[model samples]
Target: MKIGGLIKFTLIDFPGRPAAVIFTQGCNFRCRYCHNPELVYPHLFTEPVPQEEIFSFLQRRQGTLEGVVISGGEPTLQEGLIPFTADIKKMGYAVKLDTNGARPDVLAELLDKKLLDYIAMDLKAPLDKYSLITSVDTPPEILMKSMQLIRQSGVAYEFRTTYDKEVLTDADIQALEKLTDKEHYRVQECLPVAKEKAALKVLHKEI
Candidate 1:
């Protein structure tokens, strides 16, 4: 895993469980309101926290922490993700993945292996407006495929959107709502670009 950084612990990230967060390096989307630019931009990439260092910490926290959240710069982008997650699963820690749903193939593999206990996927915009919000030519069908996989995987999950009224309108949000079961949808307020990445993973609020 090309880890960008980690939060030693957090109460808000993994639903109902105390957990540590691993932020991976590199993202497919460049949302205008992104808070962790350092993780996204190649120019801002830092030396990865050694994989051994990360596992050592997890090994120590094994009994205390109930889960581990693999967040991003898009977690599915990592070539080492499956094994990395499998290693965590071996520690008897429940795993949660936060992703943009761009790689259904990878998500499918993880689900098939029962590597993830929870999933939080960001729904950037209604299918037609994804490019406007993510600043990339994201295929609507690609996003749809991921959503389908997440919903059918029988994994506990939520589809969330960052709420920045200026960037996403009420109409747009409603349109996005139409795309998912409201019981599993949420909205989070987007924060400004931060110099520090700690505690950025706030609990999601109902839409």
Candidate 2:
């Protein structure tokens, strides 16, 4: 599925499970602070890792890993996502999908197929400031739709916002919080690198 990067193993990515991470290429948003610029920016994309290669690795790690995280430059943006995820599921690994929640139809289809075990959706900003943060004219309705779908899907999930003090203020965060039911919402600080570490210092703290 046009995978741009792969982390063979991780202890924390999948939450309570040992897992492998597949980083797909190409994103719809252009958040300036995006850590993986190469994955998001077309001009910087590297040669895609062969799907077969990833399959072989997964095959070997079948028993060792408990889950597979299909992350991206926006995994739903990949054309082969459904089939690719099906293949992973067939191999007996639970799948955790990380997305920007822009594609509700795709998310719904995956849910209908019982493909995702966990989902982590990024809430970019308060509805009115979405375009300003993402650097694109994304329809707020689409994001809202996906959020609703995830909430109803009955799968374990979390809603998160990457807080960059310069881009999202305390008021913006409070407004963003009003949009979710607070079941599993999180406020993440933006990291400059690909591996994002959740800062417990900010967990559930009023912005």
Tens-digit per-residue lDDT, 123-152, candidate 2:
999988888778998888899999999999
lDDT of each: 0.87, 0.87
Error of 1 at 111 (Å): 0.8
Off by over 4 Å in 1: 195-207
| Model 1 TM | 0.93
The TM-score, computed over Cα atoms with residue i paired to residue i, of candidate 2 is 0.91
Worst 10 residues of 1 by lDDT: 198-207
Q: Mark the regions of model 2 whose C-alpha exceeds 4 Å error after superposition.
A: 193-207
* Clash pairs, model 1 backbone: none
Query: Where does candidate 2 have its weakest 10-residue lDDT segment?
Result: 198-207
TM-score for each candidate, following the candidate numbering: 0.93, 0.91
